[model samples]
Target: MFETLSALFFAHVLADYVFQTAKMVQTKDRFGSMALHTITVYLCAVVALGSIAWQIAVLAGLHLAIDALKVLWVKTRDDDGIKPYLADQVAHFITIAAIAAVAPTLWADGIWTKDLAQGGLLDISAWAPKMMLLTAGAIYTTRAGGFAVGKLMTPFAAGAPTESLPKGGMMIGILERGLIFLMFLAGQPAGIGFLIAAKSVLRFDAASKNEKAEYVIIGTLASFSWAIAIAIFTLAINNGLNDAPLLEIMAAKD
Candidate 1:
């Protein structure tokens, strides 16, 4: 059941975060756009959940239904804020959990497993589960975390200056979180301090008494906090999945 849940959640993260595009999100209220997003979800679920065609279909169908309702609710309320985003995500999670509960066999007969048998891309080694978990963690930390933190900062961003470089903030957050994730996995947690210090120094001005400064501080803190939490949690899970400690696992690779 745990394995099934992990695979399903991985698939969900990929479908909802990594694969979802800005265009898909922007026009999701339209039937064609919504259906396209659902197809992406279905394809991801198929790869993760394997030959359980009926179960995968159910999961995708539920996802589409939930998304549709969320779009309608948001449109009616004219609110595309953090609250609705969080609620929609929670609903999708519940749907995934329900599917995992009923499809425990998926872990054993999963598509990845079949691929391994066919001399395909994946190898069913001891690291296989950890690899999947790490992949999911990476995506969540960089992509999903960006959306979450952006929503969180929405209220504070009103009337703020718009003289910054285009897409600069988004790219910075992505790279920051990605680096933090790697540093933690490499057992070099202290490197984060240097990264933070560098960022602060680069952003520091002769004076710090303005909305722009405060805004940057808030976004930076939120991004750092989210990345740190995810990295720690991922490391804990990775430890549980292995007989060796994290350091020892790294040593073996050396």
Candidate 2:
């Protein structure tokens, strides 16, 4: 039953992705187009029982929350709005910090590890697939940061002041990186999925070439950074020095 259910869920997810991609190709006003596109996707999910029928219903719930936040933000705020950006950033930071703080304890307590061990798959020495997913999220963030830098450079060359370029790029990079890091720490695939969806929406509406380039650069760099960090952290943890202090510092209250 689980296998059949998982397969059906995967099919629904694939169809939703295709439908959104097609809509993006046809729509000129990227922002408006994506807003509508996501709404349609949500409608489909509701009608098809995509959320309730899925094994990972929690993920679906998280995705819904993320999408709801995105819709509210885009509708109420300007493209370069500061308040919305800050609010999102703060939320991301808090989420990541919380995850980093509690994950080690959770692992030690045998909550997730015990269940896997029962299936004869326990390996405390080895990072799980879910951990790999978190690492991927971090890498995506680093890539986004790099992309943002590139985009800002173009505007600088076109006579936009150096100050303005950096400021604009930094703002976007902060939001991107913060969200990526947070989602990774939270292990919320739904939240990450929403971020991916938001990117598609932005792509449809992105006007300035430099802006797009910057976003891409930042994303690329974020991904790279995440990969490197994960590798280093995995090594550190395996060596028996879990680096609890560093983790605590990172997770410390802002």
Candidate 3:
């Protein structure tokens, strides 16, 4: 069951995040152009459910349905805020879980088979499959996290600078979260402290007014909070994927 869920989850991430580009996202929302992107999602589901003809259709159909609902909702309300994105992802993943629970047989014969496991993928570890998931999570945390921060920090935005660097906040959020991700993967949480200290030292400005100071403080705290939360989540999920529960891993020193 875990294997099936992991496989389909990775496929969903690939379809929604990696394969679907910015242009694809914009074009997909239009009523008539939904088919191509939907097919791409189906293709991803097929890759995950290879040779399981019935399951392929099942997952693909469900995926298309969820996506269509999202697109339609976006079109009708004309609100492309973070709410829609969150709703869209939550709906799709929930559907995937429900379908997989009800029809585990659909994924039983796919990628997790012993024959395939020992053949071309003999050298691969469970971590290999998990890497795909972590990569997708990292991407989502950066973009989605930034949008979330922007939304939450709206009233506080008035005191903030119009611009700090070129593509500044977005790029910084991505890099900061990416670094935090690496720190978690490497099991060095102390690195995060150093990162924070470095940022504080650099952005130290005594002459800056109180409002901008408060703005920077809030934004930095928000960014770091998001990064830390995601780092912990990525580590926890990857541990599960590797079949090492967090408690057991924490207990091990040998």
Candidate 4:
């Protein structure tokens, strides 16, 4: 577990660096904004530790809460503007948590080994390439999805007033995609933790009723879809890796 986690950490760091670079390139003079965003996110994460069930419930709850607050705050403050749609953010968290919850079973089934952890962190260093590939894949997939969605919405946005959109739509897009990339690189739980922290800071502003409702709907769908996807992916990865015999071994012990 430790070895896997270590690899995950490195992958996460690398992916985050790349994502940050991309953001800088897109926004130009965005240093202050990025610094503030990172600091705020870290602070929120620190505060979240005080919540009950810090490992499980708190982590997931925090993610949900932040997104909920963000939508609510935005709508309330900018009633005339388009609100930040949080459907994707909510869905990503749900998917990550559901998958992570079941990951232990995969290990038990020998999809990977707890022994992998025993190998000492250095022993697994060779796996960095594979991990990097996974990280890259996640980043690509998330950016692709966002671009596709943006393109689809572009046509309708032409006649629509920009002010009709939420004040932080672009920021939300960057953060949402960044969080997803981080989660894929670092593992789901960590990713969720980061998002919860970021979202908390965003919630200082309140949302309007319609905005809140929209957020609720988007969050609800995203969470549900994520849960389903994680389960499917976990199972698929396990089977594809040919761990049935290991699972049988585990089953017999049980």
lDDT for predicted candidate 4 compared with the true structure: 0.38
1-254: candidate 3 lDDT, tens digit per residue: 44455556767777876777778777876755567666777787766655346666667777777777777887899766657666877887787777667766544555544345454323333344465556656775676577767766776657876566686766776788778766766778778899988878866772166767888888788788887776675565556556687432221111
lDDT (Cα, 0-100) at 220 in candidate 1 = 89
Ranking by lDDT: 1, 3, 2, 4
Candidate 2's displacement at residue 127, Å, is 3.2
Query: Each prediction's TM-score against the native?
Result: 0.80, 0.35, 0.75, 0.30
- Screening candidate 1 with a backbone cut-off below 3 angstroms (N, C-alpha, C), the clashing residue pairs are none
Error of 2 at 125 (Å): 5.1
Q: What local lDDT score does residue 184 receive in model 4, on the 0 to 100 scale? A: 40
Writing each residue's lDDT as its tens digit, candidate 1 over 1-254 gives 55566667788888888888889999999989999888988888777655556888888899999999889888999888877887888898798778877877676666556455584446463455566778988888898889988988999886244637898879989999999999888878789899999998876761164757778888889899989887876675566455446433231121
Q: Rate residue 229 of model 4 by lDDT.
A: 44
CA lDDT for candidate 3? 0.66
Candidate 3 positional error at 253, Å? 12
- Quote model 3's TM-score: 0.75
For model 2, the stretches where C-alpha displacement exceeds 4 angstroms are 1-63, 80-86, 96-117, 120-125, 129-134, 146-241, 247-254
Model 1 ranges off by over 4 Å: 114-127, 158-164, 243-254
Q: Give the runs in model 3 whose Cα sits over 4 Å from its true position.
A: 49-53, 75-78, 103-108, 111-127, 143-160, 206-208, 246-254
